[model samples]
Target chain A: MGEIVFQKPKSLCDVPLHYCPGCTHGIVHRLVAEAIDELGIEGQTIGVASVGCSVFTLLRA
Target chain B: MADKVLMKGNEAIAEAAIMAGCRFYFGYPITPQTEVAAYMAKRMPKIGGTFLQAESEIAAINMCIGVASTGKRVMTSSSSPGISLKEEGISYMAGCDLPALIVNVERGGPGLGGIQPSQSDYFQATRGGGHGDYHLFVVAPASVQEMVSLTAHAFNVAEKYRVPAMLLADGTLGQMMEPVSIEGITVEDHDKSWALTGTDCKRKHNIINSLSLLPEELEQWNLERYKRYEKIEAEEPMWEEYMMDDADVCVVAFGIASRVSRNAIKAARAQGIKVGMIRPITLWPFPKKPLLAAADKVKSFVTVELNMGQMVEDVELATRCKRPILMANRVGGCIPTPEQVLAQIVEANKLGGAQ
Candidate 1:
């Protein structure tokens, strides 16, 4: 078997994503999670979730 | 102890907040209070603190909510119009029971009112300026020295009660220069067990939120908050009584109007009018006890204010309308002078114990 490497970033939670299917919000959330993981800031991050669809951003995590 | 130094009221408040161990300040610049933001911008970096001039008053207050949820001291300052913009976040902070400081160095306003000293925001500050059953611990400082002391006091009380607090000043208080000593202001520590420090997967995550879909739970939250507010009302109402004894007339005022009232009161005393003043230091608690007590001894009341009869309503409520109340007021960026207040005192004295 090929070496397994790709996985969800630790900063991204294990809960099911609430975004609409095929929505780019999930993609953006992943990118943000990746950045926090790469910078090793998961333990130091404080997300200010705003109103609207983005309000659920931190709640899922 | 430090020597008294000349400082603007806005600058004194900023320095006093830093003295009280507040390290994070978020604000947007507005007239008469922009100096607070300017001072924080210059000083926060040197003290290893954070100062961010957010894009708007709303953004600045939200940043305060963010920092405050982390169990860190935070504050935001704005004028009247800007404060109206911040009311939503202020309500959220109250609903979430987060401790933060909000300063409204008020300018006249029903809508984008002129940038002049006015106490028109009294109702907004004291009555919970947002759309909810919540109250901010509101303090009105009459002088630059009180500005220094009350900044620390507001922070301490906010932390102690886990509620937002407001330092309600006006354009005159914000712009006027006075000799102030910002020494010996101590910051009391409070528990932060509910703070949103990252869990590191060690425990259940803490959520700092104001939203609740369930009506029963929301009702319970508000009830619980009011219980705390009741305790605050019982214990925290503060006012200064100047020559209240042996006076036939009592003048109630706060902030700059109180200053004007003092001069009017002295002049009235000289004229044998037997008038005194009660200056409320905490607007929310409203200093009802003293005013109610004075109602028994005084025949009439005069409320001096920079707004058109805002606090006069509070005075009537506090005194229970036991005595006839007169309002000496100026609105729309205008302030009542000592002579104007004295005239009201004379008018109240003429009523002469007539219910």
Candidate 2:
């Protein structure tokens, strides 16, 4: 089989996922991170996370 | 028709709140401002609004929190002691960026103080009585007419900034009766897209909690809130100047004290002493720009208040100590007479002249 090329998006920080496997949370996170990176406002943008599973976005996102 | 009617100050404020689209009212009974609740209770339901006399001031403000989260106008009124108890909830509202109107018809205080008019709460209102670096949009109404006008304005300002606002009237302004013109005044329109009604399973859920546990996240929130404050200060500073042109002395006052200072300023000018008055309508922004401009035209400044010279600090800071500042103060539930303020103005004038 041919070698597969896969890489994590630079918009998200390199950290192990804290959410469960097949949680569908990583997909939503990547979408938002991609938007922020595309808009070039990653420096000025602020993301607020609420209680529950979203608290993991604090330092890892 | 510009109809005029005689109404007590407290009742006028309550009517103005209803006219300003305040659909939810939650407050406990306190002296001097009890008329506000009594009026709201009789009037709120008649207008298809909600009036809840909560078990305590704390409970009343928390109820206000719930209503504000729903993006509808809510209000609560209390006297000084009751306001002290409401500090926690008021700060929480600020933290949550909720829009609500809070009225403090102040009485003498320190601990269950006398039920008399006093400006002792000036520092409390201007300096974020609750907690954190929050700043309230505070309005000081000097007359019965202003009691109506400013109450309506407070709600508009509150909604615009999404910050809690205060109508900081003293006991006298709340209890006195005068002819006020509220003809055809109605609640202004507002956009409630930010309000938190359940999404009906159509949109994302909204949370109205004020808990930001991490230090860096909380710091960012505080900075964003202060950016709004800076914009408000630039756009919303309001004051009224009387006979300030070509004056050597200026008398600064607000609320009942301003009424007395006006009499004193008239008397001082009658005796050929150059005196003027500045009535601050918004207490938080503190009218520093106009006051600093006034400093250039005058050599002396004096402040009149019902407290032991609390607002004098603001005057000194505003004037930058370039001019001498004097205080005409009365405490223990008593107010300074016009003559006392005039004496201070004259005294300040002499000192400024010599220097």
List chain B TM-scores, each candidate: 0.98, 0.97
For B31-150, candidate 1 gives per-residue lDDT tens digits of 989999999999999999999989989999988988899899999999999999999999999988999999999999889999998998888999899999999999999999999999
Off by over 4 Å in 1: A1-41, A53-61
| lDDT for B198 (candidate 1) | 86
lDDT of 2 at B68: 91
Judge candidate 2 against the unseen true structure and give its global Cα lDDT, from 0 to 1: 0.87
Task: Identify the runs in model 2 with alpha carbons over 4 angstroms from their true place.
Answer: A1-61, B184-191, B353-355
What is the alpha-carbon lDDT of model 1 when measured against the actual structure? 0.91
Candidate 2 lDDT score at position B206: 55
